[model samples]
Target: MTFSIIGRCQESGQLGIAISSSSIAVGARCPWVRAGVGAVATQNVTLPALGPQILDLLETKQFDPQSALDHALGANDYSEYRQVTVIDTNGRTAFFSGKEALGIYTAVAGEQCVAAGNMLAGTHVIEAMVPAFQNTQGSLADRLLAAMHAAMTAGGEAGPVHSAALKIAGDPIWPIVDLRVDWADDDPIGQLDSLWQAYRPQMQDYVTRALNPTAAPSYGVPGNE
Candidate 1:
């Protein structure tokens, strides 16, 4: 009942993922990423545990994207009901879409990116995202956001979006930008874009402070000065 996209941008050495689903609070169900590890998007009978489970495998330092995905899928009996996409720090890509997954859903991968979605109008939704990421230039988060926009432009999921989110992390524990619209009007994708633009400055400002705390004093008063 939904169409969504998940991807990572390699240019910034940062990882970002965006998702939009027809179901209410889609962001809460899909999309996950970590710096230096990997990203996972599990949807269509979504299993939230896969988020951390995949991360844990990556943390072991023994598994790559393909191995990690295989192991994880193998452990679950309902694996056929879920769809997943993984992109590791080295840019290795992997994806699994269950046989029972909604029609029109598809996944595609490349050297620096992986795109996947279910309940879409057709395969083009995912096809447009890969090239868009390849040709786009900017921060990982920016490119990821663009990919989601492209998916929507290509006739998005077969249903309306109720929730959307974008997540990216690097060195820092917190995501560079983690924004989710749980429920919205008819145009959740556009709403997510507007919200991301509004929050980008603040998020960037936060990262600037995190990476260089000393620089904070220059942007504001010292000791209430």
Candidate 2:
């Protein structure tokens, strides 16, 4: 079982997803985002392909978030067994929870964001996340992490979550930030937060290195002396 949020930042046009689950390597299968297209979090008997499939519907077919989610998941006979959330570049949102969703599933949609979960401790997990994202001030990444933390505070899934992920699709062809704790017996969300902090300062440098290596930040190697 899993919980996730798909969000679109109005200020910078960034699309992102923050997710956690009892399953290992949840990042490899659940969260998906394309810089100029959208984001999808497919979990609860996740069909990993569905993540990109939803994004493809949004990109290639020019479908809005709702239309893309409808077209993509509706076609799958197993759709009812899954839970998903979507947010497109335009800040539109969509979500679905299958009839067969695990224990105590919940979904909450807010301005520019949508949160969903199955096998959750309570609906409050999703409820806590939406407002956390809406109320937090800072970059999209900041709000996303805040939402994930709040979900845990409100009591996450019915069981312990072993993995967590944060992914953001900014102006580049690649994800600007994609951090994950594939498996952590301890606090995966907190570990993910630490990774984000460590990576934040280098975010722009990585982009610059890709587009203009000469202008990228110093590596801080011994040669720098």
Candidate whose TM-score is highest: 2
TM for every model, in the order presented, reads: 0.89, 0.96
- Model 1, 1-225: lDDT tens digits are 555445555556677678888788877778788877878888888988887788789878899988999998888779988998887777777889999888777888865678888888888988898877777787776777788888888888887777788777776777777888888877887888898888776776677777888764344657531
The Cα error of candidate 1 at residue 198, in Å, is 1.4
lDDT of 1 at 67: 90
- Candidate 2, lDDT over the whole model: 0.91
Q: Candidate 2 residues 13-49, lDDT tens each?
A: 9999999999999999999999999999999988887
CA RMSD for every model? 3.1, 2.1
Error of 1 at 40 (Å): 0.8
How much is the lDDT of residue 105 in candidate 1? 73
Instruction: Assess the local accuracy of residue 81 in candidate 2 as a C-alpha lDDT between 0 and 100.
Output: 91
Q: Residue 12 of candidate 1: its Cα lDDT?
A: 64
